[model samples]
Target: MQDEPTPIELTKAVADFLRSDITPLITGHQAFKLRVAVNILDLVTRQLTQEEGSDASEVERLRALLGMDGSVTELNRALAERIAKGEVDLATPGLAEHLWATTMDKLAVDQPSYASYRRELSRGE
Candidate 1:
């Protein structure tokens, strides 16, 4: 196993440092670039923290919905194909819940702070 200071922790530390310390010192286009860098770091940290669990849950949901086993990507492709062929639809058992879970996981990584996302999360939907 790895030692202390995991990737998520390290990334958060760097992002915090940049946002609190260096950002105030930068200016103009460089400031914008630094802000972008901080955002990237924050996103990376969130992924590092959440990706494994979210992906595993997604794969599990996909397997249950599709009644087959495959990697997440393969299962998703199979699902899309089935959907396109009219083999599956919103009426399928667990389909809507699976889609919602998958979408929430994506939003958790990509836009956890988005208004709608935050509202939905707060509502525990």
Candidate 2:
């Protein structure tokens, strides 16, 4: 890994700079596009910071729920196949909790500001 300012820090700084300084001088369609760019940068920063931990947690949950081991994508495909065959359902222990946790993690990265996401976070759920 490199030293000093990490990728997450650099990306976040860029987003903050655009949102604070460059945003004020733009108008109309270009301003809207600039906002989109800043939002994308913000999203990238979140993913850069959170993706590894979230993915590891998801993979662990998948392994325990499925009783097998594989890459996260492979494990997810196995889970889908089992569900499709009626082998696993909401009644399965830990299934609902795992799914909910995964969804919350995704929303945390993708839309932490979303109303329901915010509400769930407030509830410590």
Instruction: Identify the candidate with maximal TM-score.
Output: 2
TM-score quality measure for candidate 2: 0.92
The TM-score values for the models, in the order shown, are 0.91, 0.92
lDDT of each: 0.93, 0.93
Can you list the residue pairs that collide in candidate 1? none
* Number of clashing pairs per prediction, in order: 0, 0
Best by lDDT: 2
- Over 15-104, each residue of candidate 2 has an lDDT whose tens digit, in order, gives 999999999999999999999999899889999999999999999999999999999899989999999999999999999999889999
Error of 1 at 3 (Å): 3.4
Expressed as tens digits, the lDDT of each residue in 12-35 for candidate 1 is 999999999999999999999999
Model 2 residue pairs with clashes: none
